[model samples]
Target: MEFSIKDIIEAGEGYHIEFKEFLDKSFVEEVCAFANSGGGRVILGVADNGTIKGTHTDNSFRSRVQDSLRQLQLYLDIEIRVQDNLIIVEVPEGSDKPYACSRGFFIRNGANSQKLTRNEIIDFFQKEGRIRFEELRNEKAVFDNDFDERAFENFLNMAGVSRSIDRMSLLRNLDCINDEGKLTNAGVLFFAKDIDFLMNHAIVVCVLYKGTEKVHILDKKDFKENIVENIDNAILFVKRHTNVQYKIEGVQREEIPDIPDVALREAIINAVCHRDYFDRSSNVLIEVFDDRVQISNPGGLPSGLRPSEFGRKSVTRNPLIASLLHRINYIEKVGTGISRIIQAVDENKKSSVEFEYNSGFSVIFRKLDRTSEADLGESSEKTKGKNAEIILEAIRDNPTVTREELCQITGLSIQGVEWNLRKLKAEGKIKRIGPAKGGHWEVIDYSC
Candidate 1:
């Protein structure tokens, strides 16, 4: 926060900096605004017009300022410093927000401190993490009309909860439903079918672009299923469009993706778990270009998370949603997602990951070049990628994806999908791991 006094005065006031000729009751209001929003500095001896007007920094003046600030009951403490005739007052962002002086609740909007209306104050509280959306009950979501039995059952199995428990007791234990028989937002998001109808912005839209820019679209899919399903399908969309090279190591075969799927999956899960469901204007997005893959979600880092401690600390905006994902093993633990993504990318040594935040959070993965692809494979020359590769990617995306589901994913007929499945099995590229009814496909091949 150290800065040149001359430069600051010349630059005038901004969002985080204000200038005042002297300390007054309104000066306390400015401090209140700064504490309510981002912490800022107010120069006591400088006028609003940037003229240097010398003011006293004696004990009497400091006592007046301290008394006025105490009226706000602010957790933010102000620090005073003297630079010649100028007095610098440093206001820290409040640990307990909604700070206000006798005037009213004021927030710094650009260079000015504006008063907050009742609705604005409520919105501010929500933004400040006071009112959480996940824990709120959605009275509109009827249990019978919106619930997905299969999805709920799958969740129970994945979470290791027994079906012997009554439905109400199970849901209550999971904190999905209230005693009033209404579903929580977390419950609806975790098990509701066609969730977009209830929560329109609760979806993930994936797109594959032709080049580095967003000019041309090659493929697109919208996932409006349950939150967990949205994460899974969004990941599948990525693998479906990326490049992979097959390699041989003794008796074992490996399929190395151009970008690490582990990192990508972690990013996707992080987006869904941390996205601001309060925002109806934007949905989670997965965009793939020729050079990199990007995943974005509405709302940046939460209030408690500092920019410097981003990857090192974990602060989730949606704790219940994170808990559900954690139970299903979609999230191994809280706060380790960023580190895991970094670890996966580092180990793969093909692509690198970058993160950006502010109003929105985005994770970008730089693609490995084609030369690296050739180096990892059998020969320098490229082979023509066939249906087998797409099928294998689909299998990798979801080993439990059924034949009929394969037809939808591949845009192929039943006969065509069966033929490729048989061919892949006969060639020792993939195999059915269990009985036909509950089986999954496993890849063991060196073909692209």
Candidate 2:
């Protein structure tokens, strides 16, 4: 929705970008494909291969285009952007999907659009869960009543969308509101001032315990704010309770936590991104114990993801929600959160993370052994060798990596990293390339 025409032309037509040399009746069919799938742009006068051959269309053509969509009964406005001969039609996704024209239901498949038959329609609904909860229109959501200008501004700033676009048009383009100005479920989660009455179960509850059990409570908080606030607050709650080791490098100080912040944040986001919004029974839970921190959301693993395929595959139960989060840079476009969490914890020298999705998906991060960490004055040869190995692997992965970053990745204090780097340099295994500020490390030998 925030894309530039020049960029669109350079990128060429794809699933989200459809090239049309002239205005034709088949344009409605392209809209059907966009509505059924993710919303995309239909650029008129552009060649299929992205050659910009302009075409002209006035207000009457736009009116006709809007009036022609009556057959679909979708209350979505077809946005038409004019630039001399080039006309761009911004098609918002339909709330009621499986959108079809005269021929059949069309779905976007990469650079092409496919028209599905009757049998395919049924299969499509079954495979895609009929309708996503986030895309549904909330009958009770009145834009005047539920709109949170602050949250909307936050989203716009974070998403890099300009404020010049008409508020309603921007909302419609973002699939947050229908043509009727009604907010969609995704809209409510992100922009609603208060979802307590709208979506009560969407809350994120974070609790800290004295021990590994549920007997004593150290701190408890129920974040009933919007999705963004809920995630930030939940992570803040855990960080407040978690321990961090301080390491001083000259005047600069680095604090390495008991768990990697990246891993913890990813785990929390995965919990929210994959959790079933349809299930209003349980809120996402982030529990910090003395020994470990457990984060769980009430949707096992979406329908398609298998036990073995979870960390390797990318399948989202809430596509719209995932897209929104992705726009804000909260997570990756790929399904690498699980593998990332595992790698982060392993690199930190923390105990292995336990992933469970029996009743609901849960990520458990085990706390480090503080006693053994303090006793690093004299470690066994095997322990020293293992630390050396972790450091080498980390350095290989990132040559420009600093000592502070090494502290985080190796789960070592400043002192430990200094000791290892000294040993590695003495062993002639690794050497600094240049000035510490603008330099890199060069691995001199193959051996540790």
Candidate 3:
């Protein structure tokens, strides 16, 4: 939604920029391209070099453009804003449905505009629905004993799903196996014994460190497996490095782990379900520090989401993977995990969770220090410039608090809240006390 001056400068004749005196057939073609592909911007006053020449076409320019956009069959509209002396029209990407302006219909093929035939138009409209990637048939990929059976059974056992259905039958029902019986991309990622066919992009690497630096190398391992097996293995690996202390049932003593099992499960599932399978070079990574544990998955947030929106919004890049994970109890329903992760951390009286979405989505879980009661005496005001310190203090008593909650407690705005949390994570000031949905926070202030 935010456009920069560089966007205008980079604009060209096709998907980037469109020069038009008024709303015409060619303008319609540009609009259709935006609908078919992702969205794009249209600058009214610029001529390529990102010039702000200005628009003096007519007084009705805005009205006419709005009218033309409304007249389109797809009910598409544009966000018109004037910056400096230029009028910028922003067109959002439509669903699968083909868009049409007065000039027939158009679709985006890479960066160019292509006219759609009648059948193509029909097909585009028919494709308007949430595509279940798990159900898509991939007829070409071979099975050829490439799937791991023990991993498959382990996933089933962890999920507690019935074994009534055979692997092939389950695969067929999941749409990972084609009608003719072959592996889809989803199947290959989730069930493949060896991911060499895809260069092991499906693997997840985890490291446990006694300190922040990896030079010492306490323990490091890679779980090279399908999505399901990867999720299970990753959780097991994390649990191996963490210790739990539980109070005697009916006594004053309580039982607690470094991280909550439920929260950890959700974090693993979230990483596995949302990772970008398209990038064959990258794998999900989990790094443990003396103060915190960082979990990162390749390929950052998809378009339309920001680093600040994680756990708040449920915009998944791998929808089919998410659905399958949900069915297998790896992931909860959509939009539920964020709040759950927050709550888990709160109930456990740990530090809050910190998420950073940049080149990828990275989560840092801070470890708490309960041994010295003196550490708990720091004032909230003293924690200011020390964003992570204050965040840890604010969440130390309540781990389930959100960014907004942290802001409210700390008297900081949303950006301020996220800013401090990010700084804390980068400084290794915190550690996850438990899993994502039901986890607690742990502050590592003593390290710094």
Which number leads on TM-score? 2
lDDT of 1 by residue, 1-448 (tens): 2336775565445555789887777888899888876577888888887789889878887778778778775556679888888788899878787776778887664456767653555555676555458767886799989889999989877876545556765665455776577888888898887688878798899999875557779999999999988999999999999888888999999998967877988999999989988888999999997668999999998755678989985556675677668768898877789999999999988788899999999999986544533232313223214556778998988999887677566554444566668867898999899999988888888485
| Model 3 lDDT tens row, 1-448 | 2235444343223333455544455666777776765566666666544345677445477776676677566676568776665667788777646667666777553234556654655653453333334444444456777666676676566655556555665555444566567777777777777765544667789988654445566888888767776777888888888767667866577768767777777877778777766566788898876556788887677643545765675555555566556556666566577677677877776545787777678777776654322233323545555655567877777767666567556555444555566667777876666676787667777343
Order of the predicted models by TM-score, top scorer first = 2, 1, 3
Better of 1 and 2 by TM-score: 2
Rank list by lDDT: 1, 2, 3
lDDT of each: 0.77, 0.76, 0.63
lDDT of 2 by residue, 1-448 (tens): 3545765465345446688886677777788888877788988888876678877577787676566665553567767778777878788877676677776777654445656654654455575566678878987788898899999899878877656666776676566776677899989999998888888888899998764558779889999888998899999998899888888999999888888888989999989878988888999999987668899999787655568777886656676677677667786754778889988888877545999888688898876555454354337777788788888888888889887677667666555677789889999999999898999988877565
| TM accuracy, model 3 | 0.52
> Whole-model lDDT, candidate 3?
0.63
Best by the lDDT measure? 1
- Model 1, poorest ten-residue lDDT window? 375-384
State the displacement of the C-alpha of residue 61, model 1, in Å, after optimal TM-score superposition. Answer: 55
